[model samples]
Target: MQEWWRSAVIYQVYPRSYQDTTGNGVGDLAGITRRLDHIAALGVDCIWLSPFFASPQADMGYDISDYLSVDPLFGDMADFDALIAGAHEHGLKVIVDQVLSHTSDQHAWFKQSRSSRTNDKADWYVWADPQPDGSPPNNWPSNFGGPAWEFDPQRGQYYLQNFLAAQPDLNFHNPDVADAILETCKFWLDRGLDGFRLDTVNYYFHDQQLRSNPPSQTKQKEILTEVYGMQEHVYNKTRPENLGFLARLRALTDQYDDIMMVGEVGEEGRRSIEIMGEYTAGSARLHMAYSFAMLSDDFSAAHLRDCIEGFQTGAPDGHPYWSFSNHDVVRHVSRWGAHAVSEESMARLTCAMLMSFEGTIGIYQGEELGQTETELVYEELTDPPAIRFWPGVKGRDGCRTPMVWEKHAPNAGFSTSKPWLPVKAPQATRAVDQQGADGIMAHYKEMIAYRKSNPALSRGKTTFITLPEPLLAFTRTAEEQTLTCIFNLSADQHIVSLKTKAKVALGEAVSLEDDKLTLAGNGYAYLSHGAEVPL
Candidate 1:
């Protein structure tokens, strides 16, 4: 039971975008409870709910005004309790998103902290005096834009905010602050919450020295709108002090029965993997961790191999959590469709590929329906990043559209009234009612069943098999079971020569000939080298 999450498939549901039950054009806990059967039908083991805590909608609930209470937009505490009980009755674990890095400016803690220098919680947040020239204490840039420091005239100092001005970073250096946050965590656990998905897990701590980070040495032809991306992020986040906090968090969670914690490592490339390893390297820290490596646009054989191998090399004792689609980035189909023959083929391919990875897996709400990103104009933008830099940077709103349950239903069955974000016609076209016998839906169910039947795919040791471009091959072994997984990541068909032994166990576009394997565009196969196929 303790290792249930190790092989569990977690389905992520964005709070506002999932389903609207109150007809208020926003998703509430009761809405999610109503959709429990839908998630259970998809064969996922658990549901990861996005932030629904009390907020001013300043980052769409990521800025927590009250960690202990659910926002009215998503219903009240009783609704949340009912949601947990509902999910539990349906044999599903509920993982809540805990945004601990910062609190909303309106939060009592922040309000009191920013009230005056002598306030009880004045040092609770990261505040510093203005430089001699009356500028920010450091040169840290916000992830949104401008300086990471916001001038608070009430306190006569600047407070660090890695994100928006409304979200002031917590000063983790204070022991009381960390203990208070953990106490809030205990409040949830005592309420029967299973675990937590720590948001911005690496941003829990900042450099106490208030040093400025140097510019990134690696230059690219393309520029990122997130100014924070241009810097190396040395001083702002991913500090060494974060480890101790994680250990404390783990200690807190260990008090509960079979509780799991997954940290979101927001760093990029191998560095993220390194942090992922460190965060989950032992039982004293995180249970597992995920990074942007698999979420980025670099979908290649080498890229996948390097990410897996990097984690294995860095922290051999660590477990990993992989997800190709979440609330943050663009949907995988929208981002990588160009490489496939069609969107459907790409969807099936990604599902098969991700399910085969030797780690816990997460699938976003509409990913099972092969949802694509919605196209929005300037007037329709809700996400701050999209509003700030239009045209050049299309922000996360495209991927956060409401889930379409019925093709003919008004607003695609998301709500009786208009939903928060407009649902695109293309996304609505793949609604659940219309997809009763749809191939992609069938494929997802079948793939999930296959993964559950085969222990090797979920709890195996992955060994990369060298092959030419676009042909990603790896062997996963567990006990006496060994399976060969192969995928053609591009639109072009490929034929590979296979020596020794293996048979196509699960998938389409897989043809076994006289020691030759043929795969069409976006094709994948799980080959069983064991005595017999388990399912």
Candidate 2:
């Protein structure tokens, strides 16, 4: 039988900002457990919680010190079990983030590996000797800026870290390390986790020979501001050996019934979609894989079509998971504001488009509220990249602000005390309570409900329709019906010329007898053959 995640809408929750039941200013597993009803009300099939594992908090929980233990900041194992149980009770599947590509420098295995070259676990992590001149082995740059190799004088070698120096990449070449990570996954699978959201899925392996990556063939444009993207990033990530490790992960997930795994393929260019295709091509690998293709500033219809069509052609058998916003980047409403009619309209239109796509959907928390990016001052910045880059890059902390539950409550009811990131007025105004009755939240709930009610929208095959610029039109066809989805992905109004008579299905039932449909800016409409509209 097909897994639930194949046609599911997975909601992403950033644990630190999701809720704060302790009044300690930080979100914990208990806070998440208390808020499971809100998630269930959103009609999501699964909740993909960000990592809350034990970490030094250097790069947040992504730099995990212990995989088996929960960080004191986020509660203990009992809390985690409760969160899982609560989520299940609400009829929502639980998918936790797993950072298997790397571990915290504080991890016991890495500590032992860095202590001495003769240690038993010395080969557990990727370590290499410096050149004769004492220079780093390769020219690979870290994703967080500076060198990817950190000099460890104790071992007389440089350790590999694709991300922050504190988050050292594990040596997957070592079979023991791979087995150990799999065992950690089993620990959670046994505890009744639905699956995992594999972080940095492509950074699992590196060039064994430690080859230097050459310059990018494409012209160096300022558009790719992230320092890591300045280089070609060949040998540092996306190695061939990563495939076998993914296969191993798939085998482990297959041990549990109805379990699935979605990998985050972080790569530049079209390589992201290509990697997604390869990673999820067969039953031996990931169940689904998502890339940054939809997360970019490009909101053009052509671009969207290219991204979806590219994946369709590349991985005919592979499944794709699509998301526009997450904790790592700026909110889509603000990121693409120039092209949107309004933030609220954009949120509805984007969600409608996502629901219409032929793949799994991931909705980040606060998206339903039509939340925009919060303004963060220098002192309020906790994200390293934002602090290092300063005014130029506002960083991810703005997007990671605490979720607002009440408008007038302290810190908008996210915390009784100060939170990790401040909850600004703009974000607070769109709080969950305010929107619950008759706001964007209602629209989101309605949209999700509409999708669930329609078989074509939920589990249908997608086919792109020939539409002009600024209009993204597609038809989702199932055995019982065919639904046409049209979106004006621009600030300017678009006139959609229809070849046949149809009735709008979701919002309003308007007949397209004139052979032309007028769509407002950032407008979207779902059409069916009948005149009777569901709404």
Candidate 3:
């Protein structure tokens, strides 16, 4: 039987800002349990929780110190069990973020490895000796900033960290490390987790020779950071050995029934989609993978078409997951500024476009509420990237603000006390309570139900319709149904000329008219032919 994730819509929840029941200014498992009803109402098949494992908080929860246990700040094992049970009771699957590519400096394995060169766990992490001049071993730079290699005087060598220096990259070259990580994953799978969102899945391996990365002749685009992506990032990550490790992960997941794994490919440009293809090429590897290609500032129809078509060509048989927004980057509405007509229009159109794709869909929390990006001042900044490279880059804190439950409540009902990140008034206005009638939230729920009700939209084969710029048109066909989805990805009115004859279903319900299909700025319409096209 096909797995649940094949056509599922997974909602991502950033735990730190979800809801704080303990009044600790941080969201916990108990808080998540209390809010299960809200997620269930969104009609998502699964919930992808950002890292809640024990960490030093250098990179928030991404720098995991312990993978097998839950952090005290989030909750204990019992709380996790309760959350999972509540999610299941509400007919929702649970998927947690697993940072296997790296570990906190405080982790037992890393601590032991850093103590001495001859320790049993010494090779558990990527470590290399400095050159004769005491310089770092390679030209590879960390994703955060500076050199990827950090000096460890105790071992008289340098350790590699794709991210922050405090979070050291694991050496998958060591079979023991791979075994240990697999054991950690099995622990959760046995405990009833539906699956995992593999963090930095492509950064699992590095060059064995620790060679220097060659510089790219291309000019750097400072979208997120200045440290990484300045060069081609050849030898730093996406190594061939990573594929073998992914196969190992897939094998571990296969041991359990109905479990799945989605990897986060952090490569640059179209390379991310290609890596997603490679990682999920076979049944013995990742079940699905997603990249930052669609999560960028680009909102042009041509860009979207090119991205999907590129993936289709690269991984003809490989499964891919499509998402425009997540916890890592700016929200799509604000990122694509001029293209966004109104929050309501963009929210509906974005969901319509995502559901029409031929892959699994991921929707970030508060997206259903039509939440916009929250502006934060320098003093309120918590993200390291924003703090270090202020002004040039606005950082991710804008997109990581707390969820809004009640407009009148303190901290927008996220917590009684102040949140880790402030929830702005504009975001508060779009609270769940406020979206009670004819609101964006209601529209989202309706769209989700509509997609679920129509098999053609849920699990149909997609074929792109060649259209002009700012207008995206595609047809999704199943055995007995054919649905045409059209979107105007701009702030100006656009028209889609249909050369063939077809009746529009759900016309009155969704404001879509007959043969002449007219779309307002950032508008979208779902049209269906009574009969499916013969394959």
Give all TM-scores, in the order shown.
0.98, 0.97, 0.96
- What is the model-wide C-alpha lDDT for candidate 3? 0.85
**Candidate 1 residue lDDT tens string, 473-503:** 8889999688888899999989887764567
Whole-model lDDT per candidate = 0.89, 0.87, 0.85
Shift in Å, residue 37, candidate 3: 0.9
Return whichever of 1 and 2 wins on TM-score. Answer: 1
Give the range of the ten consecutive residues with the poorest summed lDDT in model 1: 526-535
Model 3, span 12-107: residue lDDT tens:
999988999899899999999999999998888999999999898999999999898889999999999999999999999999999999999999
Per-prediction tally of clashes: 0, 0, 0
Predicted structure with the largest lDDT when compared to the true one: 1
Model 3 lDDT-worst window of ten: 506-515
